[model samples]
Target: MANHVSSEKRARQTEVRRLRNRANMSAMKTTVKKVLEAVQKKDFSNIDALLRDAQSVIAKTRQKGSIHKNNMARRISRLNAFVNKARNAQ
Candidate 1:
């Protein structure tokens, strides 16, 4: 329905951006799940490395405007809490 040339171009760009953002969000969620799974299994040996990878994913997702920086911070906060608790349970 975008009749104007500008609008048509914008619509195309928006679709591409939407797909990219969705992929970024999905990747973030998957990485977060991987970290949580490590914690859930009470395996902290590899958690530090997993946390580092997750941090990178979070930062990139935030930088790309896919998710709010504060939301990412909150996620990291909860993830670390779980990690620490799991580690201390020993």
Candidate 2:
């Protein structure tokens, strides 16, 4: 338990930030999954758009401090590479 008033307020703030970060992470994961699924299904038509959406979500997540900038860059890079490979294979 938080003993001091300041500690209690800090705890509350932490909880709120945790929830916000969780939501951002969830959204980022969902967008990434959507892009992967589209690729797996060989749905090239919408893959680019999905990749853009995933990149946007990921960048936003990083901006929100839910993920590190390097992590964000790596994810976007891998996703882009996968999409490119799939397109090339087609």
Candidate 3:
């Protein structure tokens, strides 16, 4: 209920932060999904663009403290490998 005035202000702040984080997380997830789909279909032409977008999202999320840096790095590494393998396969 946030009976305290300060608590009410904090509640509002929390809501704002939650909304921002949700949007960022959704963007990150969408970027990852696009990358994975491109990898699965072996859409080589779009891979570079998708990879860059995904990498940027991942780096931003890591910087914002939404995700661990190592986790982001691992995902980026896997995505890069997928792109590389697809290129070599062609």
Candidate 4:
């Protein structure tokens, strides 16, 4: 669909970036899920570790431009709040 050379190059770059962004987002989601599961199971021993991993992944995703800074902050905040609430409930 990209007839011109520059357009073709742009299209190729877009595709590559799309794939990279998708991978980053997927990784971030998986990390978050792991943390939530640990919390849900009341596995306090590893929850902190999992939360830290999730936060790290989220920050990386934001740094990669896969997600906005505010979005990253919101996600980390919500995850932290959830974990803290569960922890305090114990």
What Cα-based lDDT does every candidate model obtain? 0.91, 0.95, 0.87, 0.96
In order, how many clashes per candidate?
0, 0, 0, 0
Preferred candidate (TM-score higher): 1 or 2: 2
lDDT of 1 at 34: 94
Clashing pairs in 1: none
lDDT of 4 by residue, 4-79 (tens): 9999999999999999999999999999999988988889998878999999999999999999999999999999
| Highest-lDDT candidate | 4
lDDT of 2 by residue, 1-90 (tens): 999999999999999999999999999999999999998999888887899999999999999999999999999999999999989999
Off by over 4 Å in 3: 85-90
Against the hidden reference, what TM-scores do the models get?
Answer: 0.91, 0.96, 0.80, 0.96
* Clashes, model 3: 0
> Per-residue lDDT tens digits of candidate 3, residues 1-90?
999999999999999988887888899999989988887887878788888999999899888877788988998898788778878887
Worst 10 residues of 1 by lDDT: 81-90
lDDT at 6 for candidate 3?
100
Which residue pairs in model 4 clash with each other?
A: none
